[model samples]
Every structure is written in C-alpha cells, then in structure tokens.
Target: MIVRLGIAVRYDGDPLVDFTPMRFLDRFVYRNPKTSEKNARKGDKNVFRRKAYDPLGIKKLAVTSEVSALR
Candidate 1:
C-alpha cells in the first residue's frame, strides 16, 4: 500500500547568519537608479546627473528637444 504525506510550511526570520553584507551587496550590485538615489538622499527628476554636480548640477538638457508623449 502507498501512503501520502502533507507538506508542512513554516515562516521564520532570515536564515542567513550574516544579513548585513547580503543586504549591502544586493544594493551595491543589483540596485536600480531610483532606489539608489533615494537611499543617498538625492531627489528624483527627469534628468539624471552624475557626481560633481551639486546644487544645480542637473542642467536642463532636454528643454529644447522634449517631445510630448501624449501628442
């Protein structure tokens, strides 16, 4: 005779003994632009400027060529 058994599921806190590095690496290697900026206290916008541009680093580069998407 064959017997069937039910699968048991459980919830628990992170299994990793060291969660810090994993979290850091996840952000360092696989992070997205929006999230990275937010984490660094940088605001979001249409133009994305690199480091060295402070206060007014993001110059309006698309004003003369912005095409309306709704049009």
Candidate 2:
C-alpha cells in the first residue's frame, strides 16, 4: 500500500522554438510555383513568413495552467 505519491511538473516559457530554420527551408521547398508567381505579381516580398508564438501569449497560457494545477 502507498500512503503518498509525488508528481513532477515542468514548464518551459520560450517562444523561440516557433521560429526554426527548418521551417523556412521547408516553406521554400514546398511552395507551389503558381502561388509564388501570383504573389510576386502582387509585389509581395518576404514570402513564406511563418507566424511566431507571442511571448506574452505563452506566458498567459502557462499562468492559467499553473493556477489550475494549484487548485
């Protein structure tokens, strides 16, 4: 019989993971030529830009989880 149990929780609050070099590489490799041409016609530069995670947003999410865990 176990009278007590221990659990461990770990949290990392970093948004840099969302901007990886591989994402840019993959985007260029997988982009459709037709789409690229259309975008170019519209004078859109810096194509294949990925949306990165917001630091404040991640912090809010972490705090919400921590609060629930305390309860």
Candidate 3:
C-alpha cells in the first residue's frame, strides 16, 4: 500500500504574514510484508512555527488512517 499525507491551514479573517509552507517529511517508512500494508511514523515536535496572530497555530491533519491500497 501507498499512503499520502498532508496538512491544511484554516483561518477566519486573513492569512498570516509569516506563513511557511508545511511538509510531511517521512523520516521513517514502515511496511508490513505479511499484509502488504505501508505507513509512516512522524512525531517530530518542531514540525511548524506559530506566530502571535495565528489562530490555528500549527495543526497536523490525520495521517495514520489516510492509507491507499497499492494495486
């Protein structure tokens, strides 16, 4: 299986001035040979930078359950 993950930023009024592009870095990749399932474990703490005016701060979308079957 192949899994694609990402993040989304939501705001009420306006976008932030110092908005940096977010990325889903697959530091480690895992796959179950028996079940043919693939996954990535990302638990880095310094994933994003938050500004004072940022309402959402830095949020990571669900990545665990976003897997696709590789057929």
Q: How much lDDT does each candidate structure score?
A: 0.56, 0.66, 0.37
What is candidate 2's local distance difference test score? Answer: 0.66
Highest lDDT model number: 2
Off by over 4 Å in 1: 1-11, 15-18, 35-71
Could you tally the backbone clashes for each prediction? 0, 0, 0
* Model with the higher lDDT, candidate 1 or 2: 2
The TM-score that candidate 3 achieves is 0.13
Judged by lDDT relative to the true structure, which candidate is superior, 2 or 3? 2
Instruction: Give the per-residue lDDT digits (tens) of candidate 1, residues 1-71.
Output: 12355656564666474468877798788866555656457555535566564444335344454552322
Task: State candidate 2's TM-score.
Answer: 0.25
Q: List the residue pairs that clash in candidate 3.
A: none
Candidate whose TM-score is highest: 2
Query: Tens-digit lDDT track for model 2 on 1-71?
Result: 23365555454654476458886788889987665676768887767778676676445556568764675
Stretch of 10 with least lDDT, candidate 3 = 20-29
